[model samples]
Target chain A: MIRRIAFNLFAWTIVLAVAFPLFWMVLTSLKPQFELFRRPPTFLPETWTVEHYWTLLSSTKFLTYFKNSVILSTTTTLVVVAIATIGAYSLVRFRYRGRESLAFLVLFTYLLPSVVLIIPLYLMLVQLGLSNSILSLVIAYTTFALPYALWLLRSFMAGIPEDLESAALVDGASRLGAFRDVILPQLLPGIISTALFTFILSWNEYLYALVLVNSDSARPLTTGVMNMLVSSFNIEWSLLMAASVMMSVPLIIVFAFLQSYLTRGFGAGGVKG
Target chain B: MAEVVFKDIVKSFGSFTAVHGLNLTIAEGEFVSLLGPSGCGKTTTLRMLAGLDFPTSGSISIGNRVVNDVAPGERDIAMVFQSYALYPHMTVYDNIAYPLKKRGVRKADRAPMVQKTADLLQLTELLRRKPRQLSGGQQQRVALGRALVRDPKVFLLDEPLSNLDAKLRGYMRVELVELHRRLGRTMVYVTHDQLEAMTMSDRIAVMEGGKLQQFAPPNEVYREPANRFVAGFIGTPAMNLIDGTLANEAGAWRFASPGITLTCPPLTDDAVSGPACLGVRPEDVLLGEGPIRGQVQVVEQTGHENIVVVKIADGIRLTGRAGADHVWRPGETIQCAVDVSKAHVFAAGPSGQRLNRPLTKDQPRLAKEGA
Candidate 1:
């Protein structure tokens, strides 16, 4: 019993240590700006206030950035998951020349650093007259997200038994009908996990957003929040924490709703049997 | 019910031939099993019949219609996969109803058909449960139910009961035979288990190395195997094959081997007298009396009988079955007799053909009388 207690205490300590920054962000966001930098630094807020949150909502472009992030992330996730699901299915199931090399090429693209592709992407977007727009950022996000999502989903698709589709075909379903009825339902947990990863990746992405879009109208949460809270003269600690907490709320919601599917997806992808 | 035929079927993947020059015809409502060990092209043959695969060169026909170009769905057939392949997300009702839905059956009419199948398979209560919730036997029944619900022209089962426990496998064997009798649908089953083929099929097609070895009734396959491979493949405590020489001495045919000699049955007109392999089932080698003598090497008891392995000479052993009433010990010298009428003599080699004269209509009793 004592050993069990010690182990539990040790485990919680590591968990809290990992979670401390997040805890501090929520705690500092609630604190009045005066309480943020106290002598010893208060563990709990001495004066809890929502004025920073009110200011973030009412005065700043925080809501605009929030809206932009939602649209950009959702669009990127839907588009990436859609294309990756079909692409991954073809890579895993179909017999064709160069299929294996095509799949390897997808993974090979993922190996290339985002910074290396950003220059070419910027050139391409400018040539298309799409620079400094949300459309350009969406295109930019697809470059990294598509490959990652496709590679992740390929293994998940391979995990599904080919016999299921054969049984469906013999049972009178057409090729697409078999995919819709049998493959899709079985692939739901995988799709959820891939969509979650793509969503979070797009949401937290910084490098592409920094390089692609410059105007306030198309700025996502990453750059918008950084520009709003951090300035040339001073850094607004409480307001930055407030923006961080707000930025994480959507992710937390997504994680909460799909927590079971995410764990199942990861577990299923690891071992075939 | 429909007749199925495969004419000169050949399936090759690149340069590796999985099946070669295969031809078979199944009469309407026949239960034919394609039986062989793994990598023997049994499943490949079944897949070609199911339209999941195309033959390199051949014509496949069902009910007199050439169906080589038809899709699996359009072929009016259903298949039970070895894995059962139940859609993991659907309940039993939906799994069985899916094919009907694809066939564009009215939704209202589907329930009664599914219900009747469920009733036939005794799965009424499991309609709401998912496949994972059921036992292996129940899942097998659901797979059969799915195939049966369609009333297709043919049913193809690929090692459907292999995943079940031994007792469940035995039980499903009888259930499947009865199911076939009731449905009267042409069924093609593929399995490696010789016992399953022997117990369940009307005729067994034994395959090896991508070629059909013998396609005959189970009794004929057991008693009169076509070649050395079939003789060794089809029995428990497989037929004892002794490398020997057969010669025509004046009028009588004689088989001679180290420390053993026996009179041989009459051969067909084309029989060649030379190096031959003698095949005798363990039961046909009667223990405790005759002209041959050997030392018992081992005795395996199985309640009803004992499989006695006797060393007749150096590097030569013959397995013979004895009644369980007698307890025979290793190293004991014993006398035995060969039932030559029931024995098979094949021309020497792996693919050596049976050289026994074909049994005529009145010759079966004559052969037994000679035994």
Candidate 2:
């Protein structure tokens, strides 16, 4: 019993060590401006305040950046996940020459660094007259997000038994009908996890957002939050912390609701029947 | 019900031919089993009949209409996969109703059909439960219910009972036979178990190495195997085959081996005097009181009988069945006799053709008595 308690204590210490930055961000976000720089730093604020949050909502372009981030991330996630699901299904199921090579090529694209493609993507977006817009960010994000999502989903698709589809076919369903009725429902857990991963990837992405979009109106939270810290001569640490705390709320909510499917999805992939 | 036919069907996967030059005509309402070991193309033939696969050449027909170009869904057949393959997301009712729904049956009409099928399979209480909620036997019944709900003209089953426990397999065997009797639909079953094929099917098609070895009723297959492969494959404690030579001695036929010689009964005109294989089932070998002598090697007690293995010569063995009451032990010298009336002679080598006439030409009479 004593050994278990000591082990648990050690485990919790590791957990707190990892989670300490997030906890400090939330605490600093709630502290008053003067309290942030106090020589004997306080664990709890002497004067607890929402003034940073209030200013972030009303006095700055924080809401505009938040809205842009939401639109850009959601659109990129939906489009990438939609295409990846069908592509993964085809890669795992249908028989044709070069199918395996095509799947390999998709994974190969993921190995290329995002920074390497940013200049070409910027030029293409500008040529298409989509520069400095949320649309450009969505396209830029797909370059990295699509390959990752397809590789993850392809393994998930391979985990389902081929007998199920053959049974559906002999039961009088067309090929597409069998896919809709059998494959899609079975693929729901995988789709949810892939969508969540894509959403979070787009939500936290920085490089393409920095390189592709320059106008303040279309900037996402990554650049928008950085602008306040870098562009200002005197930094408001409290407000920056408050923005960090706010940026993570959507991800926390998503994680809470889909925790089970995320574990199941990861467990099912790459495991043969 | 419809008659199913395969005419010169050949299936090739690139350069490897899975099935070769197959021709079969399954009569209407007949339950035919394609029996063979693994990789013997039995399942491939069933898949071709179901339209899941198309033959590389030749044609397949159902009810006298060529169905080579037809889609699987339009072929009016249902298949029970070896895995059961129940939709994991759907309830039993929805699983059974899916095929009807695909055929555009009205929802109200579909309910009665599905309910009737569920009731027939004793699955009424499981209508609302998903497949994962049921036991293995219950899942098997749901698979059957799904296939039965359509009332298709033909049913294709690929080793459906192979996954069941031994007791359950035997029980389901009877249930399937009854189901076939009631439905009277053409059923093509694939299995490697000879007991299952012999007990359940009206006719058995024995295949090996992508070729049909023999196609006959179970009794005919047992009594008169067309080749050595069938003779060796179809019996439990398989028929003991001894290498020997047949010779004609002054209007008498004699079979001679290393340690023993036997005078055989009058054989048909097809019997040739040359190297041959002598096949005798254990049951037909009398355990004691014969001219041939040998020492017992091992005795296996099977409650009702003892399977006795005797070494007649160096590297030559013969298995004989003895009554359970008569105890025998290993290393005991014994005399046994071959019941020549029921013995079989085949040409030399593996897959040799049967060279002697069957004891009785009573296949049709036996079939009539069986019915």
lDDT of 2 by residue, B191-248 (tens): 9999999999999999998899999999999999998999999998999898899898
Top candidate on TM-score is: 1
Question: What are the runs in model 1 whose C-alpha is more than 4 Å off?
Answer: A263-273, B248-253, B364-371
In the range B282-334, model 1's lDDT, one tens digit per residue, is 99887888767899999999999999999888887889998899889999999
Q: Interface RMSD values for the candidates, listed in order?
A: 4.6, 4.7
The TM-score obtained by model 1 is 0.95
Clashing pairs in 1: none
Q: What is the C-alpha lDDT profile of model 1 across A145-241, one tens digit per residue?
A: 9998998889889989888898999999999999999888788888998999999999999998998898999999999999888999999998898
Question: How far in Å is the alpha carbon of A232 misplaced in model 1?
Answer: 2.0
True contacts kept of each: 0.57, 0.51
